[model samples]
Target: MTYVKDQSFKQDSLEISIAEPKDYFALLKPRVMYLVVLTALAGIMTAPGHVHGLIGFVSLLAIAVGAGASGALNMWYDADIDAIMTRTRTRPVPSGRITGDQALAFGLILSFASVFTLGLVANWLAASLLAFTIFFYAVIYTMWLKRWTPQNIVIGGAAGAFPPIVGCAAASGSITWDSVILFTIIFLWTPPHFWALAILKSQDYEEAGVPMMPNAKGLDRTRLEILIYSLLLAPVGVLPWLFGFASPVYGVLSIVSGLGFVALAWRVFQRRTGKPADSAAKGLFAYSILYLFLLFGVLVIETAGALILNRLG
Candidate 1:
């Protein structure tokens, strides 16, 4: 629950343990990595094609590693600011468990390994996408946008949006409208999800000197932005079905989940003026993770089911 911590005030029992390799892995943010893998797998599955099992496995591994590389690189770059933010202060780099040099080396090695493996096992197109995702996340998002703009997550969100496209290219050696829609769903969902966390964590951001939306715009305006994004997300979530890639099952599920997102957004909007703002924002932030995961989970299952049904029929 509390992660690894061994502390005592008696004698010199000073815990000399550095954040283990596992801590570095945690820096990768496994929960986010899982989403990356899942959506990528869904894209590979939903696409009309055949891929060798070993190659598919390698491709996914490469994407996951690239994602972890991005996380480590981000931790390296944001170490100073991370030390000031409650949410990020415990990261390996900031906690003195891992040094920035170690992180940079780890990220660089993983990035090259991932792209090379993906290229050999899958396609050059897939490999290129993975490379760009890493660069975008490491350089663009972490180094450039994070400290400079209120729209940091809005634009930096593109880093997280690339996996499905990477997976599509991995399988079919190209991109498609369906993959773009998959990218769009996550893209639209990112700002609201992150902004909610930012709202509750505004002081942390401000203290860290990161220009988060809430630190840039007032609380009321951020809440309004959350609501607006929620409204846009509803239509985007159901677009797969509308465009004929998914079934009515996904359509219904998307609508229901989107409505839940809206309800939480409404609560956040109403609670923006009080000390309750933090609670409201935290609730929305937690639910937003669930909402996105479930939406994608259902999409994968329903899409797979449709394929099986069509085969049987």
Candidate 2:
């Protein structure tokens, strides 16, 4: 459906008439938020200190809200490009279900509320990290890097990586090496994750005038970059075990998963030029999600077991 860009006073007044609950919810980008919550929870669970039950719940909720705020701001700013890209054209802002001004207001309100509430219920360090995360994803990555450079996702990945660090700070009231390792894992993992999708969506980005890696760099270079990052990601995945924060089981699982990740990435890299990179890219993309889930899942399990044992003792 083509949405008329009606920015007149009459249209602005009709904003409430066109809006719905789902439209607002779509602003949250719930799927992406889920991964953020998982990694953040993993960081909180694995930290050496503890948080009260209520406090932990509140921190996670605040972080989720902050992530939603970032998503809203991104959609508001990218409405023009989003309307051009097939994958994003139907989003609320681009589709005209929500006005950009309303979306902007919604995001700003949530951003401030999430940060201040987290600070009050958790700690200032965690709150500050969330505040920076919102700013980075919204202003730095979304506004500047996304339009200006091929390295957009690479640098923007830090915004996604901050959740775990914030979670660690919220739980322990400070940062730890373990949380930093988690941050590094996600940071390194982001390029391969998004680049695989970028390879498939290069045409969309091209039409939208966005400088995704697959578009700015050639497909061959993009594939090589994916492989290089995948190689880096493998070792970082095992850092938790190497640093003595995880059990041998977790180490073994991480190694196995990392190898699987590398194998899939290699398959993408080895595919003959233009023969069909999608299958391999899709495989790697799917596997990357599973690989992260497995890594963090093990952390959660081990931490839960330790907590149980401690209580029993």
Top lDDT model: 2
Q: Could you tell me every candidate's TM-score relative to the true structure?
A: 0.91, 0.94
Candidate 1, residue 192: the lDDT equals 92
**Span of 10 residues, lowest total lDDT, candidate 2:** 8-17
Every candidate's lDDT: 0.87, 0.93
Instruction: Please provide, for model 1 over 1-313, each residue's C-alpha lDDT reduced to its tens digit, 9 standing for 90 to 100.
Output: 7875675475556645465879878878788899999888877766667777678878998899999889888988889999998988888888888878888888888889999999999999999999999999999999999989899899999999999899989989989889999999899899999999888788999999898999898788899999999999988989888998887888898889889899999999998567788888988899988987887788778876776797799
lDDT of 2 by residue, 1-313 (tens): 9787875567454446478989999999999899989999998898776678789989999999999999999999999999999999999999888999989999999999999999999999999999999999999999999999999999999999999899999999889999999999999999999999999889999999999998898888999999999999999999999999999999999999999999999999988456466899989899999999899988988988999899899
| Per-model tally of clashing residue pairs | 0, 0
Extract clashing residue pairs from model 1.
Answer: none
Per TM-score, the best of the predicted structures is: 2
**Candidate 2 has which clashing residue pairs, if any?**
none
| Residue 86 lDDT, candidate 2, scale 0-100 | 92
Off by over 4 Å in 1: 1-19, 306-313
